[model samples]
Target: MIDLKALQNNFEAVSQKLKKKKIDAALLELLKEESLQLKEKRNLLEQLQADQNAKSKLFPIYKKEGKDIAELKSQLDQNKEKITAQQEVVRLLEEKLSEIALGVPNIPDDSVPEGSDEEDNIELKKVLDTPVFDFAPKEHWDLDSNQEWIDFERGVKLTKSRFSVLKNDAARLERALVNFMLDFNRSRGFDEVSVPFIANQDSLKGTGQLPKFEDDLFKIEGENLYLIPTAEVPVTNLFRDEILTADELPIKLTSYTACFRKEAGSAGRDTRGMIRQHQFGKVELVALAKPEESDQVFDDMLSCASDLLTALGLPHRLVMLCGGDLGFGAAKTVDIEVWLPGQNRYREISSVSNTRDFQARRAMIRYKDGKKNRLVHTLNGSSLAIGRTLIAVMENYQKRDGTIAIPEVLKKYMQ
Candidate 1:
């Protein structure tokens, strides 16, 4: 959620910043008007209460003087009725204000590039080098030839399309990647956490995934819980509605979880292979930092993920996401795309984001600074999406004889 007080105080500045995200001006105007109306209604209610109090006091004077009290009683009753009506009005306005405010996306940082989509995103730098192949490289699905590594057909029989079962080496490789990524993150000062794969609506909303993107989630048939789309949701929400001491400002955590998504809007994209799946394994990095040091923490997180890819001998690049490409709650984002020789292109394997108090405000996660409670900046990233990394490994390490070699770093884990 955005800072409503900031919006109310600096409407023009807030409006200008939000415009980069393509927010309609009318929406902000409606929010402002609703906020103003709510304030006025609240003031009116206060006045009504004050009038009732003043009139109620007069009843005692009338009784002491032995004067007529019927008219005084009637006025008090009428005022009480008006107060009830005014209270209802205030309640409705508050609801409307909350609905509009909760739907607003985070304000883009001033450093974010202005663009409309991923194509407009700026590339920072490329890491390692794109592998040179002696022969035509084959896509992951076709490279296995006998379907011994990945069983796409049987997956559909059990579930549906966009589902696949990793078999033999592929299964072991997936598990190895998870363990290696977790260990790598832990070595970098992040505490390891085990979080539930299912999250409640409040948890989702805190991370800017609910109400707006609920369609992309797989909800329980008759419950408030939904299969988590990423470990970020549950891990970040761990501090929800809590306040920590300033000494605990930068709380870094890494988690591994099975993620599920409905992929509702993606009707016909990445339908084959593990690029997009209903269920996938991921090693996630989440951090909560003080406002003054969030930028440094963001850099550390970016390096942590990018370095992981480099260690695996995977060629990748860091690209800054433009305003349009930024996630709902992120003020800024960087996507790490790994080289896939078979696809003959780099595919996104991780995305690091600094939400900068966006999730904190929604979750009420604050840190005590002196006598004040201040929101903490939240950051989340994938050290690497395990399935996508596996695809990259298969395509990059395949020999001419159709055998796949594990990355040198993952070799120990494979044992």
Candidate 2:
């Protein structure tokens, strides 16, 4: 959640920044009104309590003077009733403020481009060159069908639409991609971790995936748990509600997990092949750093993701997300889009983001330095989305005879 004081002190500036992300200004208006109401209610409650205390003191004096204390006691009793009602009002207003705060998106960083959507995103650079096809290239679905590697029809029958079952090389390819990504990140000072695919409500909320984006989640009935949409949720929550020493300022972790998403608003997008799925494997990189070092950490994370693509010899490019395209919790984001020969365009395979204490504030994650403790900055990104990587490899490595060759870097993992 955003700092209330910051919002109040720089209301116009905050509102303008949020407007770049397409957030409604009315939400801020409501928050301002609720904040004022809470203050008023709290002051009223304090006054009532003070009045009761003052009356109690007078009661003793009246009793000693043999005067009737009945009137004072009656007034004190009424004050108590008023205080009780006022307290309840204060509690309700506080709840309203909290709800609004949680719903508010993080303020985009100053450097973030001011655009309205994905189309306005700026491309940073392209690495490697798109593969030259000897013949008319086939889409991933067509290639999978010709090679019998992915069983899309049976996946739908077994589960539902947007779900697929990998067969033979395709299954091994996904596993190989996960191992390669985890190993690659682990070799780069990232501790390999295995987190639960299911996370509790607090964990999701800590990562800023709850309350607002609940529709995109798979909630367990009669319980507060939900299937994790990314390893970011559980892995980033590891330090939630805790304060770390300054020495542990940057905590880096990598995990491979099977993610689940409802694709809530994406009705007909990427409906073919493995581009979009109900369940897919991904290797994620999550880090915690001091606020001042978050930008550097973000750049490093981006390099780590780019390195994975470079290692696989896959052509890709980095694109800076515009304000409107930024994630709910991210202050700034850069996406790695790998080239897909079959699709003949780049597709997002990973997105690295630095939330700049946004998640830390929500998770209550802090670091103690000397006499003070402050929120730590949190960052997360997919080293590579396993299924998308698989698609890239299959399309980029396909032979004229309809056979797919594995990338040289992943050969050992496949073995």
Candidate 3:
């Protein structure tokens, strides 16, 4: 959730920043009106209670004087009814305000470029180089067709479309990628962790996946849990509702998980390959940092991810997401897109984001700062999407005869 107090205090400034994300100014106006109404209702309820208390205190004097005691009692009863009714109104108004707050996305950082979509995203730098193919490069599907590496039809038979089964070296490559990514990030000072694949509603909401993007989540039927869309949800929520010491401000963690998503709105995009899957493996990096340390921490995490790609000898580029492309909980984000030679384009393999207390406020993840407790800035990124990296490896390391050569960095793990 965004800082409601900030929105209330400076609606114009906050709304202006939100406009970069394409939020309507009219919605902000409506939220402002609702907030004010809630405040008014609360004030009225307090006044009613105060008046009732004052009238009750005078009851003893009226009873002692044996004069107008009945009138005083009637007035007290009337005040009680008014107070009760006002309290209900206040409760309803508060709920309305909360709903609005939950729907509102975080304000984009001032430095975020204004744009409407991925096409408008700004490319920062390219890492490595796009591989030059001696022959016509084939997409992952065609390459897999020349071998028995992937079973797309069986995937559809077993579950549905967008789910695949890896065989032989394909499966090995996926596992290798997961292990390599986890170890690579852990070596970079991130504490390795294994988290539950299923998270409760509160955990989902804490990570900004609920009430807005629930359509994209795979909810577990009959349970209050949902299959986590990303490791960020579970990793970041580890500190949910907890306050840590300032010394623990820069907590870094890495985890590998099989992420599940409904991909409800992403129809007809990347439908053929592992690029878009109902379930995919990923190694995620999450960090909790003090406000002062979040920026550097975010860059450090991004660098670590970039280094992982470099180590794998894969070509990729770093792109800063424009405001409209920012995730719901992110104030700023940088997407690491790996070059897919076969596809002749870059596909997002990782997205490092600095939520900057947006998630902390919702999750109640705070740090004790002397007399006050403050929200911790949270950051998360996919070190690499295992399936996409596999795609990159296959596409980039494909032999002319259709056999794939494993990258040198992954050879040790494969052996």
Give me candidate 1's TM-score against the actual structure. Answer: 0.94
Per-residue alpha-carbon lDDT of candidate 2 for residues 1-415, written as tens digits (9 for 90 to 100): 8877778878899888888889888989888778877888899889989888888889779989999978888888888899899999999999989999999989999989999899999999999999888797888888767548888888899999998888888888888888888889989889999989999999999999988999999999999899999999999999999999999879999999999999999999998888999899999999999998988889989999999999999999999999989999999999999999998999999999999889999999999978899999999999999989999998888889888888999899888
Instruction: Give the TM-scores of the predictions, in the order they appear.
Output: 0.94, 0.93, 0.94
Best by lDDT: 1
- Name model 2 segments beyond 4 Å from true: 46-76
List runs of model 1 lying over 4 Å from the truth. 49-76
Model 2 lDDT on a 0 to 1 scale: 0.91
User: Which residue pairs show backbone clashes in model 1?
Assistant: none
How many residue pairs in model 2 have overlapping backbones? 0
Give the per-residue lDDT of model 3 (tens digit) for 1-415.
Answer: 8887788899889998999988878888889999988888899899999999888989888889888787788888988999999999999998988888898898899889999999899999999989988999999999988448889889989999999889998999889889899889989999999999999999999989998888899988999899999999999999999999998669999999999999888899889878999999999999999999999999999999999999999999999999888888899999999998888999999999999989999999999999899999999999989999999999989989988899998988898
How many clashes does each candidate structure show, in the order listed?
0, 0, 0
lDDT scores of the candidates, listed in order: 0.93, 0.91, 0.92
Error of 1 at 200 (Å): 1.0
